[model samples]
Target chain A: MLAEREEQLEALLVEREVEQFLYYEAELLDNRELHEWFDHVADDINYRMPRRLMRENTASVFSERGYYFNEDYGSLKARVERFDSEYAWAERPPTRTRRYVTNVRVTRDDEALAEDELFVEANLLVYLSRGDSEKHTFFSARREDVLRRRGDTFEIADREIRLDQTVLSTDNISIFL
Target chain B: MAAGDKPSVTEQALQDARDSLDEGFFPLEFFHDENLHDLEMERIFGQAWVFIGHESEIPEPGDYARRYIGDDAFIFVRDESGEVNLLFDSCRHRGAQVCRAEQGNTSHFRCPYHGWTYKNDGDAAGIPQKSKAFKNLDREEYGLAHVPRLETYEGLVFASLAEEGPSFEEWLGDFKWYFDVHMKLPEGGMEVIGEPHRWVIDANWKTIADNFNGDSYHTAWAHGSVLDLELGGEETVGHAGTGDSLDRHIHCDGHTTSMRGFEDEDVFLTYPEGVVEDLFTKEDLSDAQWKLARQALSFTGAIFPNFGFLHFGDTTDDPEKDVAPFFTIRKWRPLGPDKMELWSWGLAPKNAPEEFKERMYKMYTSNFGPTGNFEQDDVPIWKGITESANGQFASSQNLQLNYQMGLEWMSEMELDDEWLGPGFAYSENLEEGGMRLFHEQWYEMLAGNDRTDATGTPMNVQEDQ
Candidate 1:
C-alpha cells in the first residue's frame, strides 16, 4: 500500500525537476539567449564571484579578497547587451562557450534562508574555442546561489562564484559565469 | 631604416619627446619599448607608491590578498593585532613563491615547493628541514621582505618601494579632501564589495592614466558609440564633458587637479533648449528637486602620481550594484609599458542616507569594473591602441595630444577665492595640460630634481606644475 503525504519536500523539489531547470538554464546561456535566461533569476538577485587566490593549502581563496565578478541582474543584462552589440568588440566575433553546471544542491528546508530563498550550488566548467588557438584552456568554479522562488517561477537574488584559478588565463570575462 | 635616412623611430621618438616639453602627453613608443618598459618597472613602478591592495581585502587577522605591480607579485595581509603588511610573495629560504594564490585566510602560509612556513605577519614560522638546510638562518629576519612601506588612508592600501618619501598623506596632499568625501564617508571605511575585476589591456599604462585623469572627451566618442549616451563627444572630460566643465589645476609636487561646474552651453546643448519646461507632461519631482538636479556640479581629478578619483552623478543610483551614484577611486598599475591592470572601487557618500549606498554600488558595478556597464566597452579600445602601436611604424605613432590650453598661469584665472574650491584655475579646454602636469611630477620623481639631458637640453618643461 502506498501512502501519499500531503506535501512531500522531495516531491515538491524532485531531482529531475531541479536538474531539468539547471540543464535548461545552461543551454540557454551557452546559446546566448540572454533575455530568456534572465527569466530564471529573481529580480533582486545578487551575483558575485569571489577571487581565487594563490595561498597555502590550508587556506581557502573563497574567504579572502579573491573575487572575479560580483554583479546584480541589471549589470548582467548590460554585459549581455555589450556582447549583443557590434560595439562590444571583445566578443564581436562571438566566442562560443560550453558551460557545464553540476552538483546542484537543493536546500528545501533550510531554516537560515528566507521563505523566498532557495539555495543551490553548481560546479561549472567552461570551454571556449576562439580563433586559431589549438591548445585548449578551461575554467572551473563552484557557484553558491540563493535562488528566490516567486509562485510558479524562480529568480536569483544572490549568487557567488568561487573560482579555482589563481591566475586567470581567459581573454575576457564578457560572459557570465 | 637608418638613423639619418628615415631615422629609426626609437631615436626620433626620444628626440621628439625631449624636444616637446610643452605637450604633457608622450608618444606610444614609451609604452611599447621593452628596454624602457623594464626601466619603468624598476624605477617608476618599483619606486613610486604603487597601489598594492585595499585594506578591506584583509579584514580578518589572518586575511591576505595578492597583488601585481608590473610583473612583481606582492601580498597584503592583516596580522594578529590587525595591522596591514605588504611582502614579496616569496619564500625567503628557497625562493619558492609563498603565497601562490591571489588571497585567503591563513594562520601560516606553508610553501609547497619545500614546506617552508610563514606566519600571517610574514614571519618565518618553521622549515621542514630546519636543522638540515643550513647551519642557521634567522626566521624573523628571513621572513617575507615587506614592500618598502605599507600605508592606508580611506581603507585603500598603498605601498612604496622607496623607504623614504613624503608621507602618503603628504604625497596625497589636498587630494585627501576628495578621498575623505567619498571613501571616509562609508561607515566601515569601504568594502571592496567583491574582488577587483582585473583584465590585461593592450594600452600604455600612462595612456590609460591620461584617459582617466580627465579625458572626458573620449566618453562621447568611445563609450558614446558603445552606450548610445551623449557624453561630450568631441570634447574630452576636462574642458568639454557636456554636463560640466572643469578648470584644470595642479598641486605642488605634481598632482593634477580641477574645479568643475555646469556652464558649457556645449553641455545639454545636445538636449533641446529648455527641455525641462517641455517635461510638464512628466510631473514627479518637485520644483526644488528638479532645480537641484540641474544645478548639480562635480569634480574629477587625479593625484600627481597614479592615484586618481572621479566624482560625478550622471545617474543617482546604479540599478545593478543597488548603490547610489558615487565617487570612484582607481589606480592604473603598469603591468608593462603597454599593459595595465586597473584597480577600481566605488566610494559611497560618507554622509549619504542608507538608500543612497545601495544605488551607488549598482551604478559602479554596471559601468566601471571588468564587467562594468560602460567598462566592457573601454577595455577593447585600450587593447586596440596597444596592438596598433607595436610595429616599426609604431615608433612614429604620433598621439600629438595637445596641452596648450592655458600656457601661462599669469593669464589664467586665479584658482582661489573665485574658484569653486581652494585650487588652481586653468581653462577647462586645454585638457592635455593635466597630463603634462602629471608627467612633470613623474619626471621629478623618476629623474629626481633634474630634466636636463647630456646636451643640457631640458628633457621636460619644469614649469608644468
Candidate 2:
C-alpha cells in the first residue's frame, strides 16, 4: 500500500508483513475460528485454486476452467455454514487441523495496481494433522495473494491456492488449506 | 473362461431371483456378492452404452482426452472432419499406450516406448521409418481400434462396449426427454468445466447414487448450514424426514427424481429480477420458479446401475452478492464392493453470460467436489457405511434399505404432488426399490441375456430380461 500507514504503524518490513499475515491467518484457522478468518477478506473477495496437471514440459494437462475450486463471498459464507451447523457430521466432532504456512517469498514481478491494491507472491508449506491420524499432508505449489487495503487494514481481495498433487489423497476437504 | 466365471446362476438361483421379483423385491444377496460386481464390469459397463465425454471436450480437430468404460480405457478425439471418435487407448505398434497424458491437444498421438504415432482419426500414421521398420506393414490394418460403436445424444457422447446393445437413443428411451429438457435442448447445451474433481471413498457406488436420488434426509441435519443460507425457516426442503423431511418424490422407469421446497419457495428469487429474461428464453422461463421455490426446481437424474447425474446443491446469496446455482454430475465409480471413486464435474450452459458463468462456477466449487463445502460431509456418511459393513451383525444387517413407496403407497401422494414423476412417489419409505431395480437390471445385462425383450408396463422402460 503506497499511501503509507500512520506514523504509529512504523516502516513495516515486507517480510514482516507477509509473515504476520501468514501466522495470523494460521492462528485463526488452527483455532477453528472460521469467522475471524473471513474478517481477513475484503468485502468482495475472490478465491480460486485452478487444478494442476502432471505432464511433460511445455504441454498442458487440462484447463477445465471450472476444474479447480472457485468461490465468491456468499458461497464462502455458505461454505462456513457447514461448520456452523450442528448437524454437519463432517465437522460434528470438529476436525482438529493446523495450517503451517511458510516459505514466504516476494518476487521481482510483484506489482501494485492502485493505492489500495497490493499484489505479493509467497510460498506456503502446510502441515495438517486431522484427529491424530497421519492421513493427510499438505503440499501446495504456491500461493499468490492480491490483498487490498480498506480503511486501515489489509484484507484479501483475491487468492489463488495451487496444490502439488493432481489427485487428493484425503476423502473430504472439510477444512481450508 | 475360468471355472469360477462359469454361470453360477443355476436354474435354482435364476428361478429364485425371477420368482422373488414376481411378488416384489429380490434377495439382498444379489447385491452383496463379489461376483455381481465382477459380472457388472464385464457385462453392463463392458457392453452397455456408457457416457465418455461431452462433444465440447474436444472442440478442435487435434484435441483429445482419455476416458474409461468400466476398466477398459479409451481415448476421445475430434478428428480432422470435426467429428469426435472414441477409441481404445492402446497403440497399434507394440500395444503401447498411444496417448499417455490424461488430456491434451496434439496433431498425432505417439506411443512413448516405440515412437509409433496415430492420427486423431484412429489411423497408424508413422513408424521409426515406415520403409525401414519392415518391408511391408499395412497401415490400414494397424490403426487404433475404434470403439465398436460411438454415438452422441444431445452433445453428450456415449460409447457402447457391446456392438449390439440397444441403439443409443433406444437405450436412453424416454429418459432422453429428461436430459433434453434439463441438459440438452437448453438454449446452449452444457460443457464440463475442468478435469473432473476426483476422490476415492469407502462406500458403495449405490450409496452415492441413492444419496443423490433421494437422500434429502441428510440435508436438514447434515447440510443444515447450506440449507440455512439458501432456505432458512421451515422452507428447508431437502431434510428428507429427519423429522424435517420435505413433502416430495417422483419415481419412474428405474429412476428417482426429487424436489425440495425451502424458505425460498420460489426459485426465481435467486435470479436478479431484471436478468431472468436475459438468462432464460420466454419458453424456458415458463413460470417454473413461482410454482415451488425461492430458487426451487432440483432434479436427481439417476439412469440406474450406478451412472448418476444429479443436482444436489442450492442457490447462493443476493446478486449484488453474486451467487448462482451450482449443478453437479457425480459418477460413483465402483472401485470395489465398498469402495468408490467419485468422479464429479460442474456444468454450465455454454451460452451463459460471463458473470453468470462465474457465479455458477463459484457456487459449484463452494459446495461439491473434494473441496466443496456442502459435499465434504457426504464422505463421512459414505465412510460410516463402509465402516459399519465390517461389524459381524452389521455384515449380516443387509442394510435393510427402505423403498416401500410404490404405486400402492405413493399413488395417493402423486395425486396431490405436482413434482412427482410419471410413475414414482417422493416418499422416503419407497427408497431402495431403485437399488433392487438396479441389481435386477445388472444381473440381466451381465448374464448375456436377451436385450430386445419386452419392457415392463412402465413408460418407455427397457431393461435386459
Candidate 3:
C-alpha cells in the first residue's frame, strides 16, 4: 500500500512538470519570442495542422492529404525567421493574442512513445485582436504533442493541431496557432 | 436587375464608369456599393461563365462534392454512366436541401425532412408515401433542376446561368492558346492534388480580379517577405520592368496572362530533371506552345469574371530545400459587396511521381493559399481598400483610383511585335493595360452590353509605331 502511494505521488509530480512546461511555452508564444520558442523545438520535429473537414454522420474528419502546415525543422525555422524581415507585413503591426491552455493530460505508458518521450494533450483557446479595430477573433483547438524529456525540461518533438473550425473566419491565419 | 428590367445601378453611373475606364480610372465607390453589387450579381455572374470544380475532383461514378456559384449551392456529382452533373441541392417537394455533407459517394441522396430521394444523376428515384398521398405527382418532372449550361475544357468545368448567349468556345476565344501551356504541357495533363483551400475574407471579389488581371507591379513591394526569406527567387518575384528576365503581359480575348522567362533557355519551370524528362511531351502542344513552356519561369493569369491561376517555379518551402514548381488555380465568389469566398487548388502533372506531386502541393501552400507567406499580406491590404471605400466620402467626392500606369500619356508602353501567341503582348511587364481591359469589360456588362464590345484594340496598341 505504501509503494502504490509513492507511485501516485511520482505521477503527480510529472504532471505538474508537464503543465508548467506547457504554460511556459504559451508565455513565450504570447510574448512573440518566436526565436526563443523555436529554440525549444527538437531538431527532428514534425509539426502538422491538417485541414479539418465537415461531413454528415461522422463527427471527426480531416482531409486525407491536405494540410495548412506540414513542416520539418528547416521549414519551421524559415517560418520563424520570416517574421524578422521588415517586409512581413502580415505581422508588421503584430497581433495581440492571449492563449488559454487547459485540460492538460500526459501519458507515459504508450508503447509507441520512446522511454524519454511523453504524449501530452491539451485544449487551447487563443483570443486574437488584429488591426486597429475593436473586432477580434478566437481560435479553439486541441493539440496533441510528443514531449521529449531533457533533464528537467522538455522539447516539442512532434505536434498535431486539430482546429475546431472547418471554415476559418479570420482574414488570414497569419499568426501561429 | 433581379427586381425588374431596369438595372440597379443608374445609367448615369454606368456612363461615368465607361468614361473613367476610357481614361484609365476606376471609381472607388463601385467596390462597395449595395446597388452595384446587385447589378453585378444579376448581370456579370448571371450571364458570364463561372468556373466550377475540376473533373478530377469527382473521378468516380458516385463521387460528389458540394459547390457554389454566387450564392446557389450545387451538388457536383458523377453518375453511374460516368457523366458529370451540377444539380441544384434543393428538394423538389418542400425545397429542402437533400445533400447534407460537404462531399461523399452515394447512389442516392435522401432529404431528411420529407424523405425525397434523388439518384446520383439528379433524377428523382423515390418519394416516401408518394403512391398514397400524391398519386398524380410525376417523379419524372420532380427531378432536381440543372444549371442552364455547363461546359468543360481540358478537365476544367465552367457553368453559365444564361439560357442563350455566347458559346463556351466563343467566350474563351484565342485565350485558350495561352491556357493550353498550363493544361496540356504534361503527357497525361494536369490533375488537382487535393481539396481546395477555402477562406472567406472581407474584401470585394473585384479586388482579387484586378490583382490577377496582371498587377505585376505589386509583386516586389507586396510580397517582399517571400523574397527576403529566399523562398522565391528575385526573377520570379522582382520589380516589374527592372529584371533582366524576359517579362511580357499578354491580353487575349478579355483574359490576361503575364509571364517571366529566359530568352533561349529550357527552364521547364525548373521542374526536377527526372519528372521533366519522363512526363513532358511535345505531342499534344504546338511548337510555339512548347517554346513558351520550355522558357517559362512563371505564369500568372486570370479568366474574367473571376478565375485566376498561377504556375510558378524557383520557389521552396525552406531556403535549404531544392526549388520546385507549383501550380494553383483559384476562384473568388462574391458573398457581398464587402465579402468574398476564395477557393484555391494546387495541381500537378497527372503522370508525375507521387513524391513530386506532394512537393508541388507543399510549394503551393507555402506561397499562395490563405496560410501562404505571400497571400497573408495581400488579404489585409485588399480588405483595407474595401473599408476605405465604404464611407460616404468616396461616393460624395467621386474618388477615382488611378489605373493609368502604362497609359500612353503616363508612360511610353511598347507592344511585342514578334509575339507568337494570338493575344497582344506588351514587351514590358510594367504596363496596366490588362487591368484597364478588365474594367472595360466590367463596365460593358453592367451597362447591358456585350462583353466583347469592350475588346477593341487598346489605345496604346492602336497607335501608330
lDDT of each: 0.58, 0.62, 0.90
- Local lDDT at B246 for model 3: 87
lDDT of 2 by residue, A90-131 (tens): 776766666666667643234546565667666666565544
Best by lDDT: 3
By TM-score, who's the top model here?
3
Better candidate number, 1 or 2, judged by TM-score: 2
- Clashes per candidate (backbone, < 3 Å): 45, 23, 0
Task: Please compute and give the TM-score of the first chain of candidate 1 against the native first chain.
Answer: 0.84
- List, residue by residue over B1-465, the lDDT tens digit for candidate 2: 355332333434644555355234444444334565686677667777777777776788888888777777788999988989998998776787877776778878888988888888888888777887664988889889999989887677888887776787777665554555456323566777666777777666656765765555456666666665553333333444444334455445555555554433445424444444554443442343234333444555576555666453345532235444666676766776667777777777677776666666666766678876667777877666655543444324434333443434333322234542344444443343444455446556655764333133322122211
Instruction: Write model 1 residue lDDT over A14-133, tens digit each, in one string.
Output: 545666667887788888788788777676767777655455564554534334455566655555544555555556555678998888877767887997666787899988765434
Model 3: colliding residue pairs: none
Q: Write the per-residue lDDT of candidate 3 for residues A1-177, one digit (tens) a residue.
A: 999999999999999999999999999988899998998899999998898887777888889778888889998888888899888888879889899999999999999999999999999999998888998988899999999998779999999999998777888877776
Order of all candidates by DockQ, from best down to worst?
A: 3, 2, 1
